[model samples]
Target: MPQKKLPRLRGMDNVREDEELEQFGDSASLFVRDAININFTSAGRAELRQEMKLATDQALRCLWQSPLHKDCFAALGSYWCKVDAETWQIEQLIECGPGDVFHIVLNNMICMACDEGLFVYDGSQAKRLTIDTPAKPNATDAGDGSLPASDYSLAISWVANGLESALSEIDQVSLSKNSSINLQFPMCLDPNVSHVRVYMTEPGGGELQQAIELNIATRSVMIANLPELGRAAQFQYLSPMKTGNFLREWRGRLWAVRSNVLYFSEAMSYHLTDERYNFIQFPQRIRFIEPVDGGIWVGLADHVAFLRGQDVRSMSIERKASRAPMYGSSTLLHSDMIKELSQGGTWCAVWLAENGFVSGTAEGQLVELQYKSIKGISAESCQLVGFADRLVSVVN
Candidate 1:
């Protein structure tokens, strides 16, 4: 035709954008965004523990309390300060309403809870903030059995600096006897987090639920009872359940263990189906459930059992006869279960037959008891308090 001009070549004629993209595939793109390479070996376990130790040390608050000191502290409900773990020296034993506490979060804000309201403690004074309570139509005793027409007032003084500008309401849920509050504020599920759950034990001696779901993004409140509410959305017990209790959540599913149990909601296929929970009764009374690598290690007075999925197989001791009997028919003793360590340290108590009892710490320290000697231990210095080996206090 008209001297078809040789196809005009662009300046960078050889450059192929699609070819470069194909060569740098998904793996390369993913590596640039988020990459995790795990090396699994014996070294990994020790490395994990070290990382965990560093994390805990940076996050936890360490305090020391003697028996007499604790009794006086509880009696007064006062707020006091103790030495940092690094310093190992106590300081600032101030007096408050015997219920005041210094809560350290993110290694910055130290908060104090007072009757007036939740207050921010700036290592010195308590600054109170106005908090909103649920609308009580009849003002029926305001949640904690107090005859007061209003709900329990919480005063917090220290709000993490930048967070203070955003702090809307901070409520302090009281702990029942032998119970604790496991609070997850700015929860893990929602990055722009808002809601706070109040999990508490029922005054009727079971479990109770009160959800304060406020969408920080939207600033709205939603409350639902656990039994009636589906478990698909985020849900946690107001109080930690006993070693053996069944729970049905919003998403249907079934999960059980001697220590904790759950029934999942049908909406969540990833979870167990919700239905009537069944408890497995052992021929002998179960004392404790300790989780190991792949299964649960069950403790019994006479022998130990390893449970994998559903099959329960007993682990025979090389010296079974040498182990002392911990429980008798219809009677259980305090020594039957393992002793829990205080100050977030790992320690377990085990019966050693003629050896009487042995307590070992994560650090490999051993406390042994015999008929004549209670060696390698100072009971007075122990920060652990428990009944029948059920941990009660982890005093620092």
Candidate 2:
């Protein structure tokens, strides 16, 4: 008598209902039309998945867990939670309402994204990421200065801590010959602002050049003489990144995605983005962007493209044959932590795709896990959270 081997299961696929799927336990496998109330572990053991008691009346969406502390953060209907993962303790609760929210934790900084705008929580309070620009300056002809008679425009930007905000509205003024313009700037309502960077046009409509940097408390400045103008105000070509989805940090720069455009911040700077020169456009919509050791894994609409280079501008895109990734379904998994559960787990980015779960290694090699027996064909979006402790795949 021969020993009987059971049939192994590959993930579900309803698209090819008429075609026979892979069968057998070794080289091929079969798929269930639907997997209900059970999950199979890596050793091919089917464990019962039961519904447990809810801690809260409602559910938490867009959940993110911190690896260092093992705590979790989630968004309730209109609130935010700081939870202890092991004990499931709601340590802190915040009231942040009315829009879809996404959370990101970079080092000590934890930021939340919503329809209203972007905000950062400093372990206590969540503050919106905005700094008011100093208002247009009021100009008068009643001044004794070296400013010659010329029509000029003055632009100013606010600086909080070391972050320089977007340039303010330009205020134009006509100066009579030998007469100076006395400019007075209104007090900025944003308390975080500490300094103001001002730029002015030269006589006879010259280029806007760096004029002077004054403390925010200094309301008035007499344009006595234009000293050697510093560097040109090239920052005028840039804008602040107020809101974006898929916010990620890569190579000392902030990367965000909107539509089909991937916008990048200045090196080591987060607030400012030069969209004209600091963006990568794709024909298809971007689902996720994950920064890896030597490159990035970009999940596009219907394919997965690996960018193979440290420099984003020069990175080469290598598209492979694979099922499309679901929207916003990517999560970071550590090799050491994953090794406890399964095999061949490296420090790579994992995302749910139409076929199954796709993992992109830092070396730009792609390995897909298609034996999960989950149907991703009909799912428009999937929720992947707490991958370190437990893999929660909620098809939405």
Candidate 3:
């Protein structure tokens, strides 16, 4: 006697009832209501989800596990925390505004983004990168050295480690007689600021050149005979990076997003941005962004917009999807594991859409798997992580 074969359900389609699903009964199901804590095996069979719980009492909003970093990072109730990657020991890195923390690696360090602002974690604590510009230096006349004095323009920038703030307002000094210009720098209150850089125009010159770099403690300096001048002011009109929730390093530039606008840091300079030229505006809120080989994938409120090219100004943008993906739902596939699943396409940005799992490629190509499998699902925030050949999506 031949045993009756039961159909294997591949996905759920609540939009279609049993009568409507009869034609596809060998593939789909009309109901999947009680599948909590259950996962589908590779063979399309359901089983209990295998999970190992990490012990921690602090409510964590988000975590970034990085191969470049020895310690993992977490957002624990308005504080950034460092967790021992192996021992899971928790240590508060620093206090920040309460919100989800997003991360990216740039300048050989971990950059964290949250509601508060953009920050980078030094080994000791989280150091904030400032957007505030230094105030213009006060220009006055001191006795001359050798050259006759004309008009002078002075500006200053604050520096902390490798980061530099925006240039201050230009202060013009007019000298009727032969005199050296005495410039007084403003007092710096931020503890992260280490020194102040002064830029001045050579005796009547229009181009502001680097005059001197002084410790924040030294309040003023009198210039007599100018020593060898440094390079011209590069960021005279540039501003520091604005606050963004999602940040990624792509194509030698750091990209960040908040609300509906996407900002990219200036070329070669990772801390400054010219908003006029280094930003893109999406019609809707950006949910997620991922770096591809030559371009990036942007998940918006109801569509996936794929931007292709090396440069931001000339990149071609194309609309990929019409449905909303769960916020923060992007799971970056490992480079080697990309070939393990059916081996057809090298998928990078895989997200949980309203329909099912969709994999996008570096070439702006998209391949969908298990379409209509998990229908009518949405979440405010979903963290998708890949582990041990398994994709885990946690909805918060």
**TM-score per candidate, chains pooled:** 0.24, 0.76, 0.87
RMSD of each: 26.4, 5.0, 3.5
Best by TM-score: 3
The best candidate in terms of lDDT: 3
lDDT of 1 by residue, 1-396 (tens): 567322211111112343432223233321111112321232212112112234223222323232222311111224454444444333444444443232222123243323332333344543332122222111111233222221222211111222211121334443233232233333223232233333322333233333243334332222222223212222221111111211111112222233223112223221112233223345555443333223333435455444444222232222122232232111112332434334153323333322344443323233443333222221211123333323322211
Better of 2 and 3 by TM-score: 3
In candidate 3, position 274 carries an lDDT of 89
After superposition, the stretches of candidate 3 with alpha carbons farther than 4 Å from their true spots are 1-34, 51-54, 85-88, 334-347
lDDT of 3 at 95: 77
lDDT, model 3, position 257: 86
Q: Which runs of model 2 end up more than 4 angstroms from their true locations?
A: 1-51, 68-71, 78-97, 130-140, 146-153, 169-179, 186-191, 201-219, 225-234, 335-346, 371-376, 386-390
TM-score of 3: 0.87
Candidate 3 residue lDDT tens string, 163-238: 7788999999888877777889887888878888888888778998887888889989887766567899888888
- Model 1 segments more than 4 A misplaced: 1-193, 196-213, 216-289, 310-322, 325-351, 355-396
Candidate 1 is scored at a TM of 0.24
lDDT per residue as tens, model 2, 317-346: 899676888888887776555442343555
Candidates sorted by TM-score, best first = 3, 2, 1
Looking at candidate 3, the ten consecutive residues that score lowest on lDDT are: 25-34
